[model samples]
Target: MAVVTTAVRSGLLFPLFLLSIDASFQRKSGTKTQNIGSFWNGSTGRSERGTELSCCALINVQMRQVFPIHAQQTRPKKECRDRLVQYNDQLDAVLGELEHHPEILLRAVVADGQYAKDLFVETVTGHGFALISKLQRNANLNYVYDGPDQQRRGPKRKHDGKVTFADLSRFDVVNESAAERILTQVVWGVRWKRLLRVVVIQVLDHHGQVIKYAVLFSTDITMSASEVVALYRSRFEIEYVFRDGKQFLGLQDAQMRTQQALESHWNLTLLVMNLARLEALRANNGAQTLVFGVEDLKRRAYNALFAQVILVNLGLEARFEELIANPSGPLNFGLKAA
Candidate 1:
């Protein structure tokens, strides 16, 4: 299924893609798609020049399927008459729509570290939604007082001494999971300001040696640590969508110079991706498989088109079945149901 938001950026349909492709491919390989422009860097946290787009997606955890719901390109600063439009502003706008809309009911808003600012937390909380995001490895955190308030004081103490990641064992562990590696979660506050639920995962090698560590947190302090970890892990669904679009769906292939042309090309590319996935899923009884990727969809589409053309030109009505049959050669388009 596919849906677009009514509130587009600057009265234009949101551009789902914004990035530069090497024109060198056209010179060497005679590639057709090429669009060059100086766009901001949103995919990677850098101050370099590149096209950056803000995308909002809905992930159905039960089905493990993600659908891009809304997308908008980050316009240049000069284009805005007033102050600059920051990426966080675009996020807040997208999230605000998800909050008050009658059709959609998102439980929590999950984002990466880029949207982990205090202002972002406040904005999301104001809309009555929890924000789940990752914290830097050396994030400054402090312990909050859970006991009764002090009797004599101008203001009750809200925080205690600083917290050290190395001393996690001393703190109360709210949840723990035993798998290939051990995961421990605890309720902690960040920046000594906001109360949050944090999960600390310790990755270990086969020899039982500590190899790596990951820290995730949630603004919804009432949520369980396990739930926080689960939501944070599911945040990668949007990344997979981008990867599929760029790899197989002509996401990075478009020859345009104007902003309008680029916007149309980007939106169309993502729209095609959505349609292909929906068609493939429907064809397979709504089941998803790792083997049945976008490549399979393209192959099937090509064969279907070829079959139609042959039937039209040669007037071979009886040979239509044989032409549409699954190719048994090296390029097989048969459905490998999972």
Candidate 2:
């Protein structure tokens, strides 16, 4: 239901790569809780575990957006953050840093609860992808069924008030392996598109453990249920950005006192990360790129993937020169950097 950011590691700040940071509030927004930790000067080199404002990002091929944008939950953890959309002009300030033209090719986006309702979607769609986000996964959506075309010569159920497109109070949803009927509802998309709503349900197994999931999606993509899962699953990879950033990248150390400093620091961190990923993308594909299990990334190569970003970020032309200079050096760092 809610995702909390875990750490900020050492990497490039992604100016355009979106982050899906989550948190469990240690202090209430309005209930008055004083700052509890020593202003993290990083002398100890770690976040002082307490009330802190931070976030993370995820990337998926199935992501439905072109550029990266940030979306926040309806309620920001800190009231000061509640007006961030207005405060920072809805992240419009960061657009210049991205330097993306046409505003429609933005292949990545970042978001959390505090983000305005459709900020991420708008940004990504502007670029050219359809991004499905978990930040507002359950926000109520409204739409009308698109079974027939508009030109059909018949009484329209929508205009005539005789047809019910979606019923929020009731829905029918089924997961792969379950006998109990799940209670679902219509969650509409921002645009009142005909087929944008979906059916979602949370079911408990025999062990009394609750596994929340959705039945089907209404996006324009005409794929099977597995495809939908695969598409949405890309969101998990971005989630790992939060985990890896907190541990390997310096996301929270953001020692600058000014708000711009913090935002700039976070964005730069993601840029560094994207630089590393661009290298990997030039080399690997699919599972290799998304692989993040500790056992997997812990190998000297994978650790280097997150650790030796400085070397990896070196341009290909420079790398070739280095290879020519020292053939036996660590040019063997990544997986077949051909």
TM-score leader: 1
Query: Model 1 over residues 1-338: C-alpha lDDT tens digits?
Result: 22322212222122222111111011111223222224434455445544444566766544445666555555546554321235556556767655455444466878777667777677777777888888887888777667788899598887677767766754555544442333444445655366777777676666766567777787887777777777777777777666777778766565564546655766677677666655555554543342346767777777677767767798886766665454763224464454
Clashes by residue pair, model 1: 34-254, 39-50
Report the CA-based lDDT of candidate 2 relative to the real structure.
0.39
Leading candidate by lDDT: 1
Report the Cα lDDT for residue 192, model 2: 35
Provide the RMSD of all predictions against the true structure, rounded to 1 decimal.
7.6, 11.1
Per candidate, the number of residue pairs that clash is: 2, 69
lDDT of 1: 0.58
Which stretches in model 1 have alpha-carbon errors above 4 Å? 1-49, 75-85, 148-155, 171-192, 287-292, 303-338
